[model samples]
Target: MLSLVDSGSGTVVGRAEGEDIVLDVHTSGSGPALVLLHGAEGREANDAFIAALAERFTVIAPSHPGFGLSPRPDWCDSVEDLAYLYLEWLERQDWHDTMLVGLQFGGWVAAEMAVRDCSRLGRLTLVDPVGIKVGGREDRDISDVFAISRSELDARHYADPAAGPGDLSQASRDDVLHIARNEEALALYGWEPYLHNPRLQRWLHRIHVPTLVTWGAQDGVVSPDYGRAYADAIPGARFELVGEAGHRAQIEQPDTLAKLIAEHSA
Candidate 1:
């Protein structure tokens, strides 16, 4: 069983035998429960987006273990572990009919969770998610984010690179540290598989809840076609595109993304 304790720092510490997983969870607003799973960059970039979602439903956003202030447990390594951890957390909270939204890497985690069990989830939304290989061995469906230059990455990640977050040189010390931590954790979970699970596509059919897979119209990282394929694999899943946005739609076009999510969950 997982036990949660308030850490007095706006974060929740979850404990389970021999493992202490500290999750930095941010909660706001009131109504139906809506959980937002952030991208590899962590939750710092989604403040405006979360606030918008909060207007319609109570928003619960948590930094994945190893991101932000959450420390990665030695025994917990894979995305599947993260998925099960969140599932247990949800069960403990007794939240029913919850709307689960995931961005980028978090979307992958959410997908893994839904495939295993979505009884507590009423709806699912994936924005520019990366998981499951839809191509042959020689094909690269997702961009190599880790190997690319910052400028090249920004070019691929944003419809208009200038509109996205500026270079890391200009970021605050705290922001830089947060980003570094996120990158390290992301590499640990996704590097070996190159950001995809060879088996996830096979189990996507197990997700019974309504799912919406959204991609940026100009996404260079995963392409709109990849998004469509992802949506098609899941029974009854719908695919939509956000105009003038790239991989990180929540950051590049928060208002449009928020509107889409609100409508979908409604």
Candidate 2:
């Protein structure tokens, strides 16, 4: 049985997927399925965004395999591996008409999955996604992107770094391990080409689903040029930018970001 925890203004339905994945899932409202994927430093806390997104669509927010209360398995290595795990998860849930929405690294993984096999996804929504690495644009690098203190990471990953999910003083050992595991996975998949496959970029045109690529005008993590590349790589993809918001524009500017997604998901 799953326990429901109140998030002050709302509730999060929590479920334990054994050692494989024990996560706090947030789902509210009702309609076609929308799966929310989180960035490296967050858990289902990203569900806060998903919950609001649920006002128009049925949301399914799951904590990553090794984040929050979820445990990392030995088999889970590459983003492709994780993507297949997600496919299996959807099958078990018996869900369909799915719109896969992901942020940061999660979004990049979603794109990878769609290009490889998009039989299940109805649409793809990626916000400030990171997959491809550009040449000669070495500002802050993904090689050490997640290799910093919690406070430093929070600042880098959020538009309003002050609104970090919560304080770190209260964080548990589990949380720390979870964070490290995600990096380990990133390192493994990102081995040679650094979390990106050039051929995968070539497959962007093969994605049949209507893809809406959104970015923040102030995204320091990735350049607008990279965003253009992403938009250009995918055939018929619509690209838009949210001003004043950083890498986490989806959370900082939910309504504006949500509007972009709804327009395409419609």
lDDT against the true structure, each candidate: 0.87, 0.69
Residue 32's lDDT in candidate 2:
84
Candidate 2 overall lDDT versus native = 0.69
Relative to the unseen true structure, what is the C-alpha lDDT of residue 234 in candidate 1, on a scale of 0 to 100? 91
Can you tell me which runs of candidate 1 are displaced by over 4 Å?
Answer: 1-13
Q: Which 10 residues in a row give candidate 2 its minimum summed lDDT? A: 1-10
TM-score, cand. 1 vs. native? 0.94
Pairs that collide in candidate 2 are 190-195
- TM-scores for all predictions: 0.94, 0.78
Q: What is the lDDT, from 0 to 100, of the residue 33 in candidate 2? A: 88
Question: Candidate 2, residues 123-187: lDDT per residue as tens digits?
Answer: 99988887865555564345356456766656666667775545655776565555556556556
Off by over 4 Å in 2: 1-25, 92-94, 136-143, 147-152, 165-192
Task: Output the number of the TM-score-best candidate.
Answer: 1
